[model samples]
Each structure stands twice: as structure tokens, then as C-alpha cells.
Target chain A: MDRVGTVGIVGVGLIGATIGLALRQRAVAGQVVGVDIDAQAIAAAREIGALDAGGSDLDALRPADLVVVAVPPDDVVSTAVQAAAVMKRGSILTDVASTKAEIVRALDERLAGRVRYIGGHPMAGSEGRGARMADPALLSGRPFLLTPTDRTDPAAVSMMTEVAERLGMLPVLLSPDDHDDLVAQVSHLPYLMAVAVVGAATDRAIGIGGPAFAGLGRIARGPVELWVQICRSNRAAIRRSLGQFRRELDRLERALEGEEPLEILLQRSRRRAPVDGVPLDKPPR
Target chain B: MDRVGTVGIVGVGLIGATIGLALRQRAVAGQVVGVDIDAQAIAAAREIGALDAGGSDLDALRPADLVVVAVPPDDVVSTAVQAAAVMKRGSILTDVASTKAEIVRALDERLAGRVRYIGGHPMAGSEGRGARMADPALLSGRPFLLTPTDRTDPAAVSMMTEVAERLGMLPVLLSPDDHDDLVAQVSHLPYLMAVAVVGAATDRAIGIGGPAFAGLGRIARGPVELWVQICRSNRAAIRRSLGQFRRELDRLERALEGEEPLEILLQRSRRRAPVDGVPLDKPPR
Candidate 1:
């Protein structure tokens, strides 16, 4: 694969730092420059060799072949718009945000043809966040979903695909709406359910204990402010997903209240099993 | 700790095999006799060194100094009753069941003073079940809740505590009802919620294109039969927990339905942070 030229990364947090580490390990021929509003984060990125040079100044990204916007979901649009203003003409741009449709729409409406922008979300993370916790192997063996709008340049998409390949990620292409809905069902909904359960049990009447609590409360540990932004930004899709979840809860309630045979409950629950997977245990004789 | 003599394991299955292994590894000076109705399981126990002698005969437990009943909730009563009939005059009996109230009630009514039965639940397990998955270190550093009825013998409780200490666990004393409620809130209800969400997603559409799908689908990989049994046995408590969970869901729904500020939703979710004993990160500066 051809080496990438100077690459600029905005928001040197967990995702940005990880991308920088991945770039270095993969030896992508690029002078990776990181830019973060937080001076401490910028300093940390430099200390960890995650950036050749980075600062709050937009001029730091002026000479890059590609620019990656790795801010929170709420900041994706404003950051992308600002970065686009200072970007070299025809420079390709991409973002690692959870929601896609909104960013795609924002870029399409506000920065048409000034620079190519493609939306991408890597389905990976740890409970911990920030550059300090960044791992080079975080994206390895994970799926990276790319949502390229009709107006997106093919070469831009191709370039980002090369970067994803260099990071050892399997890139899958989907539309913006499709990506949003998929994440709502799989990621956003589960997170909401986890938060709700943990909230309900926070009272003194219940004591939290065991691996089950940790497993169920795993996503509840996510940054509340970030989640609020995510929930707000993706409200429509999240509400739709929550509606589906509510219906399922009602079904379970009915089954329990009606004293439906155990077999019926088992059948309904068994549908949750992966279609192609065997039971967690080997078959009992 | 003094070496246990003639250990009796009732309803020999996964937990029984694991206890046997732990005892053997510690070189407890005793013969491990396993009792189970399933002849195949008894054979497997002997083959795996989980038992020195095995049979369907409850009478075989007569000489045991310590009797551990590892059985399903529904079978706990009948098995305890049968084992109590032939238990050694001064032996200590303990049961490792998920719910404690029902078993404690059963033992109180049936055993009387024939033998001492203390209810114990080790908060440890993998997604798998059966003797094949048994591990000696399963209880290491795990909390073992012991729920002893008022009528329970002090000597018996002491013996069970010693057993837990020997196995390297922290024994926590709680009332049977409290134990039931704790597990219902943390373990049983969460499993049900996970299964419900997984089922709901699978019913609608399967977008299994990322690690998020696999992460959310993990609990769904658990055995349906085992979960069905657990849900049915702990129906009353789980129902109450689910009701509380539903109210939280309703609150979230109301928040979403209203034009209320996003801060309300975020506040409710943030309340769960302190209960988890971790300081939540502040929203991005």
C-alpha cells in the first residue's frame, strides 16, 4: 500500500491517540500531527509519540494529506466545519463518531465539495477512556463501519479504507441511516437498558454484588455527559429502539403474569440465542 | 482447619464436582462420596476424581461429617429431606442454591433436629454448566452468602463458615429474604433483561456486523433451560425487580416524550455512578 502523507488528527483523546498509535505501529508513512483543545492532552500525545506536532491552532493541520476528526458525537459537526475552513483544498476528511446520518447531513449541507468527508465508526472501546488508556491493538480484529454519502469522493473512501486496513480492521460499508439504526439497536439500546437497571437499583433497599452486577452495569459506567450528548444527538433512532425494547418487556411481563407454561417462556427467550451458535456449554449427554 | 472426614455431596453436578476438586487439591483427609439420581453423572464424577464413591443411594451419606447439597431449587427440599433421614447424628449440612428463603423454609420444616442444614450460595460461575466445566478456583475471592434460619445450629453454621474459609472465600451472613432480594436485583433480573433485549433484537433484525453485537449477545449464549429454571424458581422476587426496572424505563420514556431538558435524563443516569463506587468522568471540557 502507498504511504499516507502528513495526517492531521483532531481531538487527541482515546480514539485519536489510539489511531496515532495504530498509525505508528503499522508504519503508515505519515507525519502524524495531533490537535487537541486541551493542552494537557496535546502534551500527553506528544510524550507518548502519538503526535509529531500538535496544538490548538488550526494551522497545525494545514499541510496534511488526510484529516481525522475524533471528537465526541456532539462536537463532530462543529469541529468538522471549522477544520474544513482551514483544510487544504481537496484534502480528504473523515470522523470516528457513533452517529453518522447527522454528521453526513451537516457536512453535505455546510461544506459541499470544499473537502471530501466520509463518516466512520469503529465498533471497539474499553470502559476506560482518554489518551492514557489508548491501545494500538484496540481496532485490530474489530469491525469499522464506513458511511459514505452519494456526494462523497471515491478516492477519499479508498484512502480511508487503506488506513483502516493498515490498522488491522475489517472495513464494512453501509449507508448513514443504516449505520445509525444498527448502532441504535445494538449499542445505544443496550447502554440505555444498563443505565436504567443500575439507576433502579441504586436505592438502599438493594445491595449490588456479584459478577452479574458488574456485567449488567458495565455500560452504566460510561461517561454520563458523553452519553447525554449521544442520546440527544441520536434521539430519534434511540427512541425508536427503546420503543422496541419496551414492547419486548411487555411481552415478558404478560408471560409472567399469565402464568404461561415454562416452555413458552423458554421458547421466547431461546429466540434471543444467536442463530448459528451452539449453547455456551458443550452438549450435555 | 481440621481435616474433614467422609465428605458427602448430594445432587452431584457442576458445583459438587468443583467442591470435590477443591477439597482434593487441599488434600482434605476425607472420602468424597457423591449422590445423584443420574447414573451417568455419578459415573462421570468418579471418572473425573470428583468422587471416591458414587451412587443414587441417599443412605451413602450416613457417615459424612460434612454434607453439601448442590442441587436445583425445586429439587432442594426433597433431596434435603431424603438426605436428612440418614444423615450422621452430628453432621453439618449445607446447600449451594441460588435462592435461600425457600430452601431454608424447606429444611426448617423437614429436617427439624435430625441434622443441621445451612443455606449457602457462592457467587461464582462461568457461562457454561455441568461437571465438565468445574474448576477448583471457582470460589476463590468470591462472596459466599450464608443464610441460616434461626432454628439452625450454631455449630453447623460455624462448620459451613470454615468450609467457605477453606475454599478461600469471604463468607457474608445475610437473611434468606435478603439474599433472595440481592440476587434478584443483581443476578436474576439482569440476566432476564439481557435475554429480553437480545431476543427483541433477534426478532426484529440481525445486524451482527460488529463486536457490539457479540458483546450484547453474550448473555444470550447461556443455556435457555437453566435460565428458565432460575426465572421460574425466583419468579416473585424477579417479578418485583422487573417492575422496578419498568418504572425506570417509564421515567426515561416520559423524559423523552416531554420537551424537558436533556439534563434530566442525564441526571437520572448519573445517579447510578456512586452506587458503583467509581467517580464518573466529567463531560468533555
Candidate 2:
């Protein structure tokens, strides 16, 4: 693949640095430029060979064909808008945030006609934060969700998809609302459940917990502040998902009084089918 | 380790076969014999080199120094009693059941004054069932819970501990009630939570689930029939655990209205400690 012109990445944190490293290593970008408020992050990214050029200014993105806002979920919209203001006209702009609906809506409204803004969320991360922990292979084979509105440019979507593939990611398209709701159920809700499992564990229970118990509590070990932001950002969908979860828990609790009911509930729970009506027996990808 | 003479396994299923294989492969046993009502299972165990000798009769345990009832939870009690009756006096009898209170209580009463009954639960398993999937290394470094009542012989516990070590297990001693309660919170509750997660997931939610969601749902993919038996066998403890989990969920839901409360709850949830007052940062052992 011919090197795409300069790629500007905002934040220069884990995701941004990883994108830089992957793009540079794979020769997908002619120059991988990074900008961050934290000068230390920029230095770290440069030291790790994740950046060809780096700075703390938006002007650094002016010559880039693609600009990626890789900030936290709460900062993605503002950062994308600021980067878009400096990006050359017709150049594509995208983001790597977990939640999408609010960020995409904000960016589409604020950066309209300035740059082609498309929402991208690489479904990958590590427990450790910052550029030091960024790995080029982190996003490989993981789902790269692109939340594109009908108003989004087809050219922009195609560009982002190519970049995602170059980074060894599997690009999947969804609406911003769909993306938020899907993650609320799968990602956000499961994180909360893990937190609940850990919070509710009795001292006695902790004493004798084997691998299964430990496994359930594993996902809860992520940073609390980040998860708190995620939960707050996608509250409605998470609440709805939480309600659905409560219903299932209630069903199991009610069925506990009788052997047959419990057995039937478990049997029903075992049936798993994909959205395309495919029976799925394999572990989740 | 001196070779343990004539280790007899009552059920040549996954756990039983794994035990047989590990014992024989490590030369921990002088001879490994297996008995299964299912002739096919017996053949499979023999074919896998899991047993030196095999049969469909309890009399196969007549010369055994130790008999492990490696049957399903529902059948553990009856199988243990039967095996005890067939074995000569002073031979140790143990079981490999997920839930222990009921099985241990039944065997302690029935096999008293005959064979020394020590309840053993090796906390290792695979989603795959039967002798064909038996793996000797499956139990390596996994917890081996020993639930011994006052009536249980010290010698029997020591012998089971020695055997568990030979199988590469870390033996943990807990009372029968404690064992049931601990698993109810950890194993059984987590399994139920995984089921609830699967049951509650919308089609669209599943479509976009990343690794976190997949990891949470992985534990639920085990055989439903087996889990039903486990849930039924430890109903009271499981119900209590479910209540604790529900209370935590309720707290989270109620706190959802305010950021500070939710943040506080998550912060508290992040604190993990072992029973010995150790700040545990490690995954469950």
C-alpha cells in the first residue's frame, strides 16, 4: 500500500500513539504527526518511534490529509473540532472514543463543511494508560467501529476503513446511536456488573473463590475514573441494558425456588443467535 | 513421591479421567483403575491412557487405597456410598463435585465407621465433557478444596492433600458449609450472571460486543444441564449470594441518578482484600 500523506493524531496517548506506531511501522503514512496538551506524552511517543513529528499545536495538523482525535470520551468532540479547524479542506477527520452518539453529533454540528468528520472507535485498549503502553499490534484483528451518519462523506468513510485495515483492524459500520446502545449493553453494562461482583463479594466468599470467581472480577480492575465517565456519557442505554439484566436476574431468583423452572431458564439462556439469524456456538470475536 | 497404590475412580468422565491421567502420567499411582456405568466412557478413558484397568462394577475398587467419586453433582452421593461399601475398611473415599455440603453430609453419615470420607473438590474443568476431552494438566496450579467434617479422619485429609499435590493442585481446607457458600458467591453466582448477561443481550448489542462482553459471556457457554444440577444442589447458598449481588445492583442503579454516589460506589468496589487481611492485587487463585 502506498503511504497515505501526513496523519495528525491528537492526544498522543495510548490509542493515538498506537495508531502512530502502527501507521509508521506498516508504512501506511508518509509522516505520522502527533499533538497533545501533555508535552511528556509527545516526547514519549517520539521516543517509542510512534511519531515522525510531534508538537502541542493544532497548526501541526494543517498539512495532514487525515486527522484523528484520540482523546478521552469527554474530550473527543472539542479536540476533533479544534483539529478540524486547522486541517486542510476536504481532508478527513475521525476520532477514537469509546462512546459515540454525543461526540459524533457535536463534531458534525461544529465542524460541518470545515472538514469531513467521520466517527471511528477502535474496540481495543490495555489497562495501562499513556503513550508508554501503546503497542502497534494492540488494534490488530479487533473491531474498528465507524459510526457514520447519512450526511457523512463516502470518501471519508472509505479513507478511515483503509486506515483501519492498514492497522490490522476489522472495520465495522454502525450509526452513532446504534454504536452507543450496543456498547452500553456489551461493554458498559458488563463493566458495571464486574464492579458489582467485586463490591458484593463477602470476606468468606473471597477466601474460597477459585478461578471462576476471579475471572468474573477480572474486568472490574480497569480504571474507575474512565469507567465512571463512560457510564455517565451513555447513561440512557446503560440504564436500559441494566433493566434488562435485572429482569433476567429476577427470573433466575424467582426460579431458584423450583428445580424445573431454574433448569428451564438456564436451558433458554444457553440459546445464542447472532443478529443475522446465525446460530453462534463459537466464543465471541 | 511414593506411588499411591491402586487409585480407583468411580466415574470416568472429564474430571475422573483427568485425575486418572495425571496420577498415572506423574507415576503418582501404582495403578489407576476406573469404573463407569457408561461403557463408552470407560472405553474412552482406557483409550486415552487415563486408566491401567477399567470396569463397570464397584468391585473394581476392592483393592484400592483411595477411591475418588468423579461423577456429576447429582450422582456424587450415591456413587460415593456405593464405592465405600465395595472398598475394604481404612481406604479413603473422596469426591469431585462442585457443591460439597449435601454430598459431604450424606457420605459422612452413610460411610461412617466404614471408609474414611474426605470431601474433595478440584476447582478445575473444561467446557468439553467426557473422557475424550480429559487433560492431565487441567488441574495444575488450580485450587483443590478439601471439606472435612469433625468425623473425617486426619489421615484421610493428609492422603487427599498428598494426592492433590501430585495432581499439581494447591489444596485449600474449608468446612462443607463454607465451601458451598464460597462457590455460591464465586462460581455459581458468576455462572448465573453470565447466563443473565446472555439472556438479556439484545441482538444489536451482541452485534458490536468487543472482548470485554465476550469474556463476560464465555463462562456461560458451559453445559446447561450440569449447571442446573450445581444450582439445585446449592440452592440456599446461591440464593443468599444472589441477594447480595442484587443489593449491590440496587445500590448502583439508585446511585445512577447522581455522579458522586456512582463514583463513590465504584471506588469502594475497587478495593479488594483476602481473608487473611492481605491487600490482594492478584487475580483469583
Candidate 3:
């Protein structure tokens, strides 16, 4: 039930504009302001009624009680630091980057006591890009991961939790490193698999490909630059996940050659990736 | 425009039942009969109006002008041979199996010149299984691949093309070997990738996994026994595709490690995958 008086959103891209729309439409914020380097993006977001006021100035974030930096993954830490410089004392600063460990550590070291810094990653997105494709309901019913270190203010985390609920998201709290590790296994690894599939299948295979191939290759069409940064930011965890994937791939190859049991491997995979049943993974404590 | 006087469908499972529904609903056949080893499957197909007549005897196929064998991949050749035995001379025999080369070769040697056999692979399916989940609309607007060799009759191919069109499918003609090769790369390889992803992520990462992971893992939840047969049937092509996949995966790993330029690889992948654009792959000749 706790609503922020004013919210400032940096980068007015898909996630940023979506959050702005959700906050404004759900009455979670008294005023929603957006700041973007691109004036056209700011105008596009404001035209969609996602922002009460928005401009291409850091000054626009000054009156806000909370600031959400929703830039590209590589720019997250820098944008948060810049937003923090303009944000008033006692205001909370957070980000919507896909990776969290590096960002959280940098922000904690730079602006720990000066301003409340919390890291966030809302696990929701559309294949479509930009503020024009932004939807208020995109955040609803999705897991909103909050990566808060020991140095992060508890009040900031609580406020973000309330905001996530107001936007109809299931807020999940975890340490920054844990967030990075888990997402590497689930999100980043799957994305890389798509990329590899697209690369391997090439034009020849894609021509005759069916719905299954299309479904598997869906995320391969995502923005490359953003994904590159995400991979770079979470290199160690992604590498570990890729190693696991290689071993699994080897098992599948061995099964195909009749050296291993195919049915058992497939049955185990089916259990791990349930189609309709409740997931088997343990929830974060 | 060419309609079969009587259509016999063996194996009233998902694909078979769906084909029956399409034929019956679209008025593509004068009479539709189904025969399955499981009496319950025949009843379920009948309940859904997928068949006008169905039983557990091969004698039901004696009057059929066209017999479609829609059993598991491993059973496809055997069922087709069995169906051919009861089918009157000059009757066309086809199948709706995922793999075509082995079955086509086996049938050509066993029933060549005796019965008209054209191999078929409908590029459509749902995650849900059995006759109860069958949909008439499942075959509509999907690619229905027909594999015919020099021994295949032209009239049989034409009749099958008409049937595909009547069911609202895009009929594509290819050699049995080509059909197996393409599907191995597109369908079978993607399925393996999903299996590998599930095996790698396991239950530990699935708890916080989002839509991307779910999308990539969708086919991993498919029937294991069926997939095992599919893999066994198209082992050579699938192994080749896996090799290509491993090389691509190596490139991705190198990209992640800053050993390769990531953006170029991603841009090429985006072009190949083609989320909303006309796919870069050449259409079947």
C-alpha cells in the first residue's frame, strides 16, 4: 500500500516505459517522470501516457523520491551513478538491468551511504522493442527479482517490493551474486542456445523448419548489443552454464549413438522442463 | 479436386486423429475409416467425429482408396506393410511419420509395384497427445511434406497433393533423404537443444526461469519414446546437425570470452532466425 510520491525513470525504452505506464495507470506513484538521452523516446513514452513529465535532462529526476535506471546492461552502472548525482538525498536508486552482481558491487562502493542503492531485474519482456510497444500489463504476474546486498537499505527494498506488488509482479528477493548465477543458468544460457541454433541451422535448415524450430529460435532475434553486454557482465556464470550445457549436449549425443539410454535422458528432461505441471525447482528462501 | 473414394487411417493417435478430423470436416473424402491397435483410441477419434467408421481390424481398409499410416516412427513401416497387405491392389499407401527415408526405403523394397506408397511428414503437432487432443485446425496452413522416389506413381503424388490442399496444407515435394535431412536439422536438432537445456538447467535454475526458458524448453516435455524413435530413425542427419551445433556453440563461447566479434555473429543469427521478416532461407523447390 506504500506509494512513492514521485518516480523518475531513466532511458524510456521498453522496460522503462512499461514500468512508467504501470506506475501511472495503477496509481502507484503520484507523478511519473522519465529522462532519456533520446528526446524522441521521451516524447513517445509521454504520448503513451506513461509519464506525467519527461525530458532529456537529469534535472527532471530531481523532484522524484525514487529513480529507476532502465538503460542497456552495459550502461546500467554508469547511468545509475549519473542519476544518483542528480537525485536528492534520501531518494532510492535502482536499475532494471538483466545482470546484477557487478552493478550492485559498483553502486555499493560508489554511492552506498550517500544514497540508497538497490538492484532490480523484472523478468518480463516482449519480442517487440521501444516505448511504442510498451504495455502496462507486461510487468503483471511476472517475477520481479530484487538483488539487494548487505549495504543496500532495507527501506529501499521494502519500497521496491510494494511498487512491484502495485504493478502486479511477484517480488523475489535474493543476493546480487545469486541473482546473476540463477539467471545465467535460466535466461542467458537459453538465449545463447537460441543463438547457436540459429547459427547452426542457418538458412538451409530454417527454410523447412516448423513451429518447434521457430519456438526454440524465438529469443535469437533479440537485440545483439544488449545481449553481448549481458554476457560480458555475467561472464563467469554464463561460462559455467555453458559448460553444463556442453555436458548435457554430450549426454544427448551419446544417447543418440546408443551408448546411453535415450528414454531415461528424455524423461529426466521432461521432468526438469514441465509443460503444464508446477515447476520442480526450489523457490528462493 | 481429386477426392479419395475411401480413406483409411491407421493409428488413431494425435496426428492420425487430427488428419481424420481435417478430412472429415473439410469433406475431402467420401468415406473415412480408422483402425488402431487400441480400441479406446478408435472410440475417442469417433467421439470427436474424426472418423465415420473405425475398428481394430485391418479388414476395414479393404475398400479404402487411400490408406494413411500414422503410427509411431518406428511402427510406421511395419504398419504401412500390414495395411498394404489388406489394401486392395492399386490403392495408394502413405504415412504421417516424422522421419521418412528409412520407411520409404523399406516400403519401396517390400511393397514396390504392388501398392502405391508415398512417404509423408506433416510439419505440425501439438504438445498435447492422443486422439482427445486432436484438432481439425492443426493441419491447416502447415507444411505437409511428401517424399516420393522414382518408383512412386505420379498419380499417387497428385492425389496426395490434392488431399494436402483440401486439408488447407501447403504440400511440398522432396526426396525421402532430403526430408529426413532437413527435419533432422530443424526439428530433431531443436528438440535435442531443448533436452540439453533442460538437462543443464535442471530443477535448480527452473524456479526463477522466465518465458524465454519456458519457450526454449517447450519440446523437451514431448513424448520421450516417440522422440527416441525419431532420433533412431534419423541418426545420421541429426549427428551431422549436432556437429554444426557444437561448432556454433564454440563460436558463442569464443564470443563470450572476447576471442570473437559477437555483434556480427548475432546480426547473422537475427537474419537467419527472422522473427517477423520473410525468412532468409530459400523456399523448397
TM-score of chain A, all candidates: 0.90, 0.91, 0.95
Instruction: Order the candidates by lDDT, highest first.
Output: 3, 2, 1
lDDT of candidates 1 onward, in order:
0.76, 0.83, 0.86
Candidate 2 lDDT for residue B195: 81
Chain B TM-scores, listed for every candidate in order, come to 0.86, 0.92, 0.95
Badly placed stretches (over 4 Å) of model 3 are A274-285, B274-285
Of the candidates numbered 1 and 3, which has the greater lDDT value?
3
Q: Write the per-residue lDDT of candidate 1 for residues B51-130, one digit (tens) a residue.
A: 88989999999889888899887788888888887988767888888888877987887788688778899887776577
Docking class of 1: acceptable
Instruction: State the lDDT of candidate 1 residue by residue for A15-85, as single tens digits.
Output: 89989878876789479998889999988888887888899987888998889999998898999889988
lDDT of 3 by residue, B1-285 (tens): 656789999999999999999998888999899999899999999999999999999999999999999999888877888889989998899999899888999998988867899999888888889999999777777788999999999978999998998899889999998888888878899899988887887464687778788786677878888998999989998998899989999998898889999888887777688442236454224
Q: What is the lDDT of residue B210 in candidate 2?
A: 70
Q: Model 2's CAPRI class?
A: acceptable
The candidate scoring highest on TM-score is: 3
Residue-level lDDT tens digits of model 2 in A131-221: 9999977787778999999889998898988888988988999999989888887788878887788778876566565655666556776
